[model samples]
Target: MAKTLLRSVGLFGAGMIAATLAPAIGAVDVGTYKELDQFMSVFERVRADYVDKVDDRTLIKGAIDGMLASLDPHSAYLDARDRQNMRTQTQGSYGGLGLSVTMEDGAVKIMTSQEDTPAAKAGLKTGDYITHLDGKLLYGGSLDEAVDQMRGKPGTRISLTVVRPGRDKPFDVSLTREVIQLKPVKWEVKNEVGIININTFVNSNTGDSVRAAIAGVQKSLGHDPLGYVIDLRSNPGGLLDQAIDVADIFLDRGEIVSQRGREKGDIERRYATATPTDLAHGLPIIVLVDAGSASAAEIVAGALQDQKRALVMGERSFGKGSVQTVLELSDDTALKLTTARYYTPSGRSVQEGGIKPDIIVPQLSDADYKARPRLREADLRRHLINEAKVDDKILEDDGKPDPRFQLTADGLKKQGIDDFQLDYAIKTIARMSQPPLRTALAGAKRGAK
Candidate 1:
């Protein structure tokens, strides 16, 4: 069954993945031969007459990258460096500045640095833009290229010029590379509620870690506890199966998510009733997502919300519902292909317009909430389109203020309210646990400015 998985994957319009010699096999016809000849003609001309000397490998890699990139933003050619990086990811360790980054406006923008990592220790914040590496100007290279430069042997020091938001000047921060062992699940019992923060889905055993955390919280509390709050804010996604496992941990039954390929009627569904998957033990749960939440993170959030297993809160999530399947090539390289799109159990596709929470909660304590321009799958160049009817503009904020969110960031800061979203979730959980809190919250809501 494991061996036939690849063959079965082809049925979902990933037929090209299994075709190893498709170019040669399909070039039997005269027209196909002519097309192949045309490709070679351009390739030879660039190699022979280009002003700068170009190697066969460089030209071939460029051609491969272009071909895959043309398909979608998520698809790309992974060179040897990229393949090695993928291997490092599976090992759950990398010697680097320990920052998750993306290319935005010709700069390498930091997306939430992992805690206790070099990036976080060095005072890196989300939304800081790295304009240069070690004094050399960096004007937009691929995200992989920028990350490769930041990674080196342990103890190696590198400097980055960071342009922070609301700052007048860009500053340089020196950081030493270190081997980062990511702990995907961390839980703490706050006010008798389990606050589980799944930072990333990098590890295959993330679900197990979460289960252990939940158990530990229950053990420490010496009680069933009120509920759990799964915080998925600023969590850019990782492994797909980990997401599935995490979602299943909360869902007792029903379909979790489905992936449909380019071919019509070609889809695969993942269900949660397979093996007693509900690990929360039928407890009340709330999921918190922000504009930075995406991909695998969105998967778990959407599943729980669709199954009515958890209440989703916060702003619309960053829609990145496409699946990237890495196909290895003969040359120690690979192709990160976007084979299919993500769909909720309700058959709803939040491709560009991400999952809307049951209750929209804003980050009142974060002053930059109004100005923070977060990236979405829709913002990506050449992102895969959702065939389902979707209004991309629906994800945009109307610039209208909600009366319930009348509290100012400055006022919250004065009151030492660091995180309004978390505070709201805890209050909501407390209300759920004690009915009297609901009356208090209701009166406060009515009196809210």
Candidate 2:
């Protein structure tokens, strides 16, 4: 089946090609004679006429980059260093400065500091522009280059110059690189509610971590949690199957997600097959999402919300409904292509326009521009563009306050709800624990069963 799909995509590419060779066998024939002649001509010209010596590796990397850039945004040729970093990210462990940095306006800006990491420990806040790395000026360098320079052996020190928001002078700080193991799921029993903060949906361990968190909360509560606060803030999604597994843990039996490709009859649906292990049946649950919550994370939030299983709070999610398939090239390098798109159980495509929260919350304040702990619109610019529409019927117009529930620079000043959206979720869960609402939730669960 996989081979057939690949062949179909290859055929489609060939059919669309105007100047390329004809489609033959499984792969498209790229006019062998012409390619050979062109290659020799370029090689001869370089060897005969070049004034300066060019490194072979540099030339090859440029060629690879150019080739992959023509396909799509997600498809790229990763060198050895890039391949190693990709492995580190997926495994959720690395020796680094513990900050997610990106190239913004020609400077490396701190997107979000990982919790309890050296960057966070050293008071590195989001939106801080990194000007220097290890006392060397990082002006006009790519984010990948800066990040690679930051990662090194454990206990090695690196210096950074950062310009913070509302500050004119660049601040210099030195941090030590350590073996940082990113714990995807973080749960705590707060006011008798299970507050599970899922940073990302990666690895097989995420489902296990969530179960453990629930068990711990249940043990402390002397019963299963009466309510749950799922924090998916800043969670740029990871593995798809893992996201489905996480949703299955909450739902008894229902469709978690459905994916559809361009070809007809390619529709596929994944359903929940087991009863929930954490909260008892009909337990009040609220899922918190923001612009940073995306992809597989959006899948979970959208599924639960569509089924009326969880009250989704906070701002609109970062919609990333496309699916990427990693294709191994003849060389050791891989091609990650956006093959198909995924939809919520209700058939809403969260592509361009992400999932709208049941409760619309804007960011805390206009002037207090602290980067929310989730992926924002700016972060997703590098991803491929595949637009999908959302059904208006499934969306709720809960005319309350905007769910923008982060700690605004001003809100941080006063004693207001720092994370007002999460606070609202907690309060909503508490309210739902009342007899009447509990009965409604019970009915919903019974219908799901």
Candidate 3:
């Protein structure tokens, strides 16, 4: 069986950085030889006439990099350093600012910052552009270069010139690098409700961590709590098998997710176990997702939502639905190639459109929520297109304001509610526990706004 996993830079990776081990291909046709001949022609010219002295290894590596870059943004050629970075991240420990970043038009754009890390502590939000590193311009630099610069000996300080969307001008944020030891799952009981925070799916044991969290919640409360709130905000995905495992924990039956390759007959579907594996025991559950929840996170959310096991709340997801298979070209090199497009159990492809939440719960805690623009799979250059047409009207509808969400950050703070989305989700579950209080509380909460 192939070992399928996803990774980006740090905890919450940027774009879709996942891979599966594949055997080397040996077939080559005459038409390919002609293309190789053309490539060799350019290679010879660069080697002979270039002003700077170039080595064969460097030229070949550059050619490979250019070849992969021509494809979708998710595909890339991973060198030794990149492979080591991927391994360290999936293992749940690394030294860096703990930010998941990607290249956009030669500038490095932040995907999301991992919780409790140096980047998150420094208040770097998604969609912020890193224009300079240590007062040196980083524009037109490769993502690999940026990542290599950011990740280094722990405790070393670095300054970043950030260009935020709503800010009047660029600002410098100084941060010290630290080892990011990821705790994939964290559970706590709030108002007799279980809140499970899944930070990332990069860990192979993430599914097991979630299972432990469920058991811990029950043990901590002396019984099964009212329900669970699976918080997947800013969680850029990880292992494919762990996604199936996590989704399987909630679903007793039915398909969880499916991946389809280029060939018409090449399709694989993952289903939940028939056993009574629903740990919550049919309790009311809610899945919270934001624009940063992607790939494996979307898989779990899509499975639970389609199976009617949980009510998905919050804003739309990051919408990265493709799978990358890492083919080892050499001992120290691999090709991360996008080979398939995954779909939800209900046959919905969340490529550019993402997983639309059943309830659109905006984050009222952030004062700059409305000013900051969101970055998703659709926004990337050379992204894979979803064959099924997406309704633009439906996509545009998510931006509209709701009367129930009229509260400002100050208003929420005064009410002692720092996170309005989480507070609302917990209150919603509390209402479900008491059916009689639903109408009265709903009216009061909505009318008060």
Candidate number with greatest lDDT: 3
lDDT of 3 at 64: 72
Q: Where is the poorest 10-residue window by lDDT in model 2?
A: 1-10
TM-score, prediction 3: 0.90
Q: What order do you get sorting by TM-score, best first? A: 3, 1, 2
Alpha-carbon lDDT of model 1? 0.79
Task: Report residue 137 deviation for candidate 2 (angstroms).
Answer: 2.2
Give lDDT per model, in order. 0.79, 0.72, 0.86
Q: Model 1, residue 10: what's the lDDT?
A: 18
User: What's the residue-level lDDT of 443 in candidate 3?
Assistant: 58
TM-score of each: 0.86, 0.80, 0.90
Tell me which residue pairs clash in candidate 1.
none
- Report lDDT (Cα) of residue 317, candidate 1: 88
RMSD of 2: 5.8
Question: Model 1 residue 11 lDDT?
Answer: 16
Task: Give the poorly placed runs of model 2, Cα more than 4 Å off.
Answer: 1-51, 104-106, 122-127, 163-173, 275-280, 330-332, 362-367, 370-383, 389-418, 441-449
RMSD after CA superposition, every candidate: 6.3, 5.8, 7.2
Q: Positional deviation of 260 in candidate 2, in angstroms?
A: 2.5
